[model samples]
Target: MDTDLLRTFLEVNKTRHFGRAATNLYLTQSAVSFRIRQLEIKLRTPVFTRKRGNLRLTSAGEKFVPYAENILQTWGRARQDVALTDSYQQQLTVGATSLIWEINNTNEWLEQVEAIQPEWALRTESLNRQQIPSALLEKQVDIVLTSEPPKLADLQQVRLTNFVVVLVSNEPEQNMNTIIGLPLVYLDWGTRFAVEHSRIPALQRAPILHSHGCQPALKFLINRGGVGFLPLSIAQPWIDSCKLYFVKNSPIIQNELFMVWLSSNEKYEDISVLIDVFSETQNTC
Candidate 1:
């Protein structure tokens, strides 16, 4: 059972054409055919139908599909664990929302925590809102840095900081007047931010640009001369320099950052130490 053979089988099964599969897998058609033949010989049965030009899995191959998938998945996780073993005593897989990592500077926060915990290996992931749940439930991520609490059972949320998002602009007038038709760069903070934002005035007239994360939205604002909601910490210096301004009477959405983790885990003792450090931090950031 070579994983490569299973992979080829899976790809061929997907494409239903040996040449297409070979193109996708970056191998020659002859090589792909040879691997499938080798697999059939090892399994003592043909795994695919060769009827005319139609390519499909045989009954035995159909039944073995799930098992092959699991084998590959488990092997992939094993490889990740093996790679982490040499450099780390114990790995803390932290999944952070892009807004937290890129905009709010969660990397600096992780460094502060890592300074105190020498024995723990910090592995950080910049995940979007949609990717966090499966990553946590599957144990690929041991900790979560998010603005909103996850609703899944067996998880506890530790409150970190409450921050405000204010409308900032790089327009020449640099005032509330620039908001209308300013090509608003909407960064997805969370559902709560969206709900809060709906009440703001002149937003209905805004030419919208949706961004997946904060950094790109901020960059677009600076480079293209638009108005959008940026974190207070992110927009402060520009606001001071007369390059950007707060929109008059714009809705200020307050969001809280949280560290979410499994409640029944032994790792919480070590994780609590990190949470405690966040709690003691100076709000200068």
Candidate 2:
């Protein structure tokens, strides 16, 4: 299988439009169409429908999508491993959600990595929760530390810690019930959080204000007087300092933090070292 063709297929699948996929892949639309046709010919099946301006995938495409993604991911990981071998000092690209950065002990994990493998160079980036899993699959990141583990095929997730998610409000008199009646601020990548909240019968009609980052959501809560969910680690200090208060007897949502990466890359020496370091740090935290 040609890796570039598979990548092109995945890109078209993601965008569901030839022109957009072409723009992203730096190819002309005609070239993108040709690649898709080539993939379809190789498989001896129609992958996409072309009628009525609809770009829907056929059944064959749906069935082949996951396998194509895995093949591309494996190839990318192999290339990265070979490239890392030339550096002598192993390079690990780590990604985390913005909420993780707010915790005081987050940097301690980085220091522990350096202590365990002094010859390894660590590259860290803060990504939105939605991007973490994709980053790992594309081999742009070696490990992703996130409060929520995304559901993706061929990935391994190790639980790092369990934390309580609490609803916080800046107003004193407002309780969870009253707050739910007003506009609520939510993180954009908070799928698990949104799913759990949607199950609450009491909040069925509540209006939501969506923000992409925790900082913006927090600021919105403070400045606009709304309720938002936050990690206890981040909200406790403010609660103690009388800066923020818990909104009523809201159910405490329990979230498990996970260190996720490709299982295929786990056998690599540098990844193993970093995993050990992260496991040790999680144990102590």
Candidate 3:
């Protein structure tokens, strides 16, 4: 089946109205209806119920959603794989959360991979924690770097390293009470950090600055002179430069980071080699 037909079906399914979907897809309403009719004819089943002002999917249509999505995803991955030039032996796509990229020196890791495996092409994507699991499962990414591993039977997780999040501020001489008086910049490390963070009453309150990852929180601390918890790896540079100071009395939370990929991946051995490079780099870091 043409992927365009699947695209039209999904768009109409999303909008639930042929006219709206047509407008969004930059096609005429009649064209959208034609595509849906073609899809139904191919499937030999009615995918949508034609009711005036009550557009909805038929039972089969609901079931077809995931299949259509999977087909498109597989098609996209295939395109990427086939697009590689003659110089490349294979492509490895690595997806990581922004914080993971920053703290783990992921760019350097990729550089190392390229140096050792000069024939391989490397691709990196910055994804959030929420998007990692589905990206891995759908073969959208070859590997994912994250702190919390998604609990899925088909995915394999490997521990990269453990990191400590320490409370740091510009004012090193300030005690806990004085530090608490300063604005707190909260960075969402992960579930484990949240659990450990709740134990500290001073860090429990609403933050003056909030971010999903380290860079924003780190920037806020440097520019605005607020206190926040950051991975030691990320905070070390500024701490060394006397830009940020460790809050000695604050609780330190340790979290393990992991890289995950599909267990059934075709390039399992090749992926393992890339991971070995990362592990070796981490050991030296």
Candidate 4:
């Protein structure tokens, strides 16, 4: 099976439109159509149905989607493993969202990795929560540390720790009533938090101020006294120091953190070592 063709099929399935998938894959629409046709011929079944401006998957396509994803993932992992073995110095790129960076425990994990696996060349990047999974898929990063588990079919997630997402405010008196009416500094990754906590009647009407990173959100929370959810691990020091206070106890937000990598990478020695260190650190946290 051609992994490239399977990728094209997956992209088309995701977008549900040939043109859009072509744009995403940087392929001509005709080329995209040809690939799908080739795939259908190989399988001897129709994969999609064309309706009024909508492309719906056939039963075969629905069943095949996960299998296609697994194939691509397996291929990618195999290629990466070969590349790593061929290189003289193994390079491991790790990615994390800003929220993970602010956690003191995560910093400790990095230190432990350096002490334990000093020979491996390590590079780290901070990306938005949404970008971490894609970064891993593209092989731009080797592992992603995230508060939310990735839902992609090909990815494998290793649970780290569960943490509370608390609403932090500079002004203690603001609390729920007054804070809910103010401009809340919402983190870009806070959408899940918002949805989970939206049922809190006070938050439904709050004016939102969006920030791309956690530092800016924390700054906004400090300067403007707006509500934002932050991990307990990161916010605990501030709370203990009386720098930030919880806004309301109503919508208690909590999420599990995961160290995610391609499942095939689990066999690589370098990745295995890092995973063990990360797992130990998370357990301690």
Candidate 5:
């Protein structure tokens, strides 16, 4: 069985649109369709209903969902086991939204953890904002650092930090109108930020550039000269270096983050150390 075909099926199932799944998987729509057809031929049953522009799972497909997920999980664990080092006694699988990755310096933190706890092997994953919650519920990752916490009762969410997000731009002097009219790179902060942004009349128009994460927005701001909001901890270092400037009178937004783990996890002490690491990392910014 081809794992790629299984992956394509899962992506299509999640999005319910072949084109959108292709975009998410970085494949052409035709390629995704081909993979699905191949999978159907292999399974000898149609998994999806293709009718009147509707994309839906058949009854068999619904049942196969768990099987597909299990196959992927088992394969993943096998790969990890194959690659395990003898020096590491424990493994920590972690994931983070891209914005959280930037704010917390998560990759560097993993390096620090590896240095301090050589007995533990830490793996980090970068996930889309929408994917984090479900991934946490599935125990696909041991811990997730995200902008918003999951609502699942099976997971434990710890409030990690409340940080300021300030509007930043290449220019120093700014007015409300100018800042609004300027080519903007809007980062999707969260629901509360979305509500507040919608109330601002000038922001109703779509931005010149929009990203779900801060890194791409920040990159565009640096290279192409646009205004966008960034964590103060991220923008502060750049501001001090004169690489970026804070927009005067621009709205400052606050975003809260949480670390989510399975409540059933018995490694309370280990999880606590990770939480402390995430909390104390702000001082390094």
Candidate 6:
């Protein structure tokens, strides 16, 4: 079976919409439909029951999920193993959310890996929340760093570090009450931030702006004048330079960073060394 077909099947299962799956795969909708048809022909079973606006997997389709995932993973590992050069003993691929990359100094960590382990080949990918779990399960990534960890039976989740976020404003002299009344730039920190934010009566209203990444929110807050929660590490320089200030008496939110990988990975010992290197770098910083 063609891996493209399996990828298309998984994408369709993920989005539940043929058009959306096509858009994600950069294929035409007709192409997606045709692939599904070909897959059904090969399987001799209709994997999905297609209603006008509702698409659902058949029992057979649900059963096929694990097999498809396993096939892809095995293929990926085989490809990586075959591609290894004499110069490199092992290849490691790491994926993380954009936020984790920024806050955790992921680039520096990667550089450190190169300095210490020149024989190890490294690949880095930017992953979203939806892709993190599947990426690991499929062997598309060897490890994933994320703020919102995935709860999968096949993965091991390790608490890496805690990051501090504080509500900061461009207006230094503004009181917390006054700052809350101004336009708000809401940054999606993670699940914990969401829960704590809901409990705050002052922030109950809709934000003037919302951003997934910290830099845009921080830029907006600095230029446009608003309050937003920013990672202390990134916001420290701005705070010191008088471009931003901590909102007086505001709640401090600390979020956890996690590193996750397949529990059954044959490279558990080697991967643990890389994890230790990361932790040491964080500690020294």
Q: Is candidate 3 or candidate 4 better by lDDT?
A: 3
Residue 42 C-alpha lDDT in model 6: 94
- For model 6, state the Cα shift of residue 70 in Å: 15
Q: Where does candidate 2 clash, by residue pair?
A: none
Q: Which pairs of residues collide in candidate 5?
A: none
Per-residue accuracy of model 1 over 1-285 as CA lDDT, tens digit each: 899999999999999999999999999999999999999999899999988799889999998776776577557656766777555667677888777886555766677767887667777776768767776876767899888877889888776667778887776555554567678788778888888877776675544678867777777887787788888888887779877777776667777777898866667787777776676554434
Per-prediction TM-score to the true structure, in the order listed? 0.69, 0.62, 0.69, 0.60, 0.70, 0.68
Go through the candidates in order and give the clash count of each. Answer: 0, 0, 0, 0, 0, 0
Candidate 6: misplaced stretches above 4 Å?
1-84, 275-285
The lDDT of model 3 is 0.83
Worst 10 residues of 6 by lDDT: 276-285
Model 3 CA lDDT for position 94: 86
Alpha-carbon RMSD, candidate 6: 5.4
Model 6: per-residue Cα lDDT at residue 12: 98
Q: Please give, for residues 111-177, the per-residue lDDT of candidate 5 as tens digits.
A: 7668777788776777777777766765668888776776777777666557778888877776567
Off by over 4 Å in 3: 1-79, 274-285
Task: Write one digit per residue (lDDT tens) for candidate 3, span 164-201.
Answer: 78889988776567776889898887787778888887
lDDT of 2 at 161: 60
lDDT of 1: 0.78
lDDT of 4 by residue, 116-151 (tens): 776565567777767766777767677887766678
lDDT of 4 at 212: 59
The digit string of per-residue lDDT tens for model 2 on 144-254 reads 877777788877776666667687888876665687566677654467877887876555664467765667777777777667777677677777877778878788787
| RMSD vs true structure, all candidates | 6.3, 6.4, 5.8, 8.2, 5.7, 5.4
| Global Cα lDDT for candidate 6 | 0.83
